[model samples]
Target: MRSPVLGAAALFAVVVLSLATASHGALQYGFYKGKCGTKDVETIIQGVVRQRFFSDTKIVAALLRMQFHDCFVRGCDASILLDGPSTEKTALPNFSVFGYDLIDRAKAAVEAACPGVVSCADIIIAATRDAVALAGGLKYQVQLGRRDGMISQASLVNLPAPTITVPQSIQTFRAKGLSTSDMVLLLGGHTVGITRCSVIKDRLYNFRGTGKPDPTLNPNFLQLLRSFACPKIGGDNNMVFLDDPSSSLKVDNSFYKQLLQNKGVLQIDQALALDPATKPIVQQLAANPTQFLTQFNQAMVKLGAVQVLTGTQGQIRKNCRRTN
Candidate 1:
């Protein structure tokens, strides 16, 4: 049999190749070296994230989701952090995305130590890395130098819907220059966080208006889910853990294992196992938690680098919620 070590090395190669093609040249490991004061910016961001994680463990997942939301809509420019009645944060899909206040707090700490040095966009990325680390995920380095965008338009927030199919999800990721493997790996972020029963109720009842649960769902698990206190309609805020309830707060490869068992909470997640293109990758991740974590880190690094504003493209906003 082929060695698992070799398998992982090969997978890492694929990740590097996918990232090398798209990463901008401006991002570097120590982009803030001389700009920030003696206090390392990454250290300040991590300190705040770690402290917040103690008060609310869910903040880790929220920060991760926040990074994804920001990157997907406007290329990781802190656009999702913008404040206004019509900004991206006010978009319907982003209604539940929290952690903006946490970002602000971390930004304030950074500004006190090194004013006008680090960008809120980079702070968001650093906070994401720290949050993942505190939540049991393996650590990975993030390239810096991303500048904050000056605009946040709700009309531009075009992320894929929860009901989308695997093909549709693949296309959505591809539009952002991510590959099939990247899509599967990044979607594993679902391993953390909670979802509202209302967001997933349609899959459990009246799937496609047929008054039947989705056949893809494991029957036993479906019955268990149906028994939850969530109402049949309009209980959008009734939340359920995303992963195995026992380890919902931890970040690992349990999501792939859940997908293998037809316990995925979202239609797109179940579609990962049902679709041939993504199924094998899902299976591999389920079997090798280390490989899953490794790829997840790589995918996140690549995600942070997507269409990022760099150099003279965007400015460092004093306030994340405004352009300044």
Candidate 2:
């Protein structure tokens, strides 16, 4: 009964509304805001960090391993946090320090507070965020209810790169459904951590000469770096360092600023600053740390939503480092 133009307009409006609803649903199911509150999970996470289950260095390393795995495959499933000889042999970083001890402490605490309710995977994720907060960034709540992946496929550890190019890193993150904006926001986590020369020595010394130095780094900081350790062609572990000055103990957004200036420690770290697709996001976060934190929390929520094998899919391993 209506005119052709009116009918077409009505159909177009319906399509637009449907797409908008779908988008909103994706964000909500994948990235809804949640409260950390005084929940037992939060308490457990804080308790572990406070008690020092592993040294600050170890915790950060574990978090990086987890982030790498999560972004590589599906989402941040706590597979990297699993412990055991089988898992250890297959681990990406070869089971550096994160083990069942920390997971046991958290499990015990959570059990006492609220038994059999929280997932070990969720604890690891929350604890990582707490660790970030301790290092120097704003604290945000991570959503809970993630289940453990029963089958920890050690072979999957091969996915992450010890050193990655900026474009490759962007492609990896994009493959996981993250946008360039999400990639930069997430890398902001580097703002509070440390990187050993073992990771970036090649980028710093081999390709580029020590005399020139990367112009992005603060001249004074670069001078300090040069004094620490010299790079080599191949070494087990050498002593060279780049540290986040904001709060080495907490996680925050200042890392992006470092990237903007070319102080990013690794190839991938610096790449975020240089990439055309991601540079603007990095700049925006560098300009507004608080907003970055807020968005980072949201991204964490989404990352935690990847194909989780919860409920019956997986069981709580007696030891988090190994499959029981």
Give each model's whole-structure lDDT: 0.86, 0.57
The CA-based lDDT of model 1 is what?
A: 0.86
On residues 178-206, what C-alpha lDDT tens digit does candidate 1 reach at each position? 88888888888988878888888888988
lDDT of 2 by residue, 35-146 (tens): 3235645765687876673354456545644554543553444666654566533654554434345667877776666555556677677777776666555565555556
How well does candidate 2 score on lDDT at residue 60?
55
Top candidate by TM-score = 1
Residue 128 shift from truth in candidate 2, angstroms:
2.0
Candidate 1: Cα lDDT at 82: 89
Q: How high is the lDDT of residue 39 in model 2?
A: 65
Candidate 2 segments exceeding 4 Å error: 1-39, 53-75, 88-100, 112-115, 208-223, 231-243
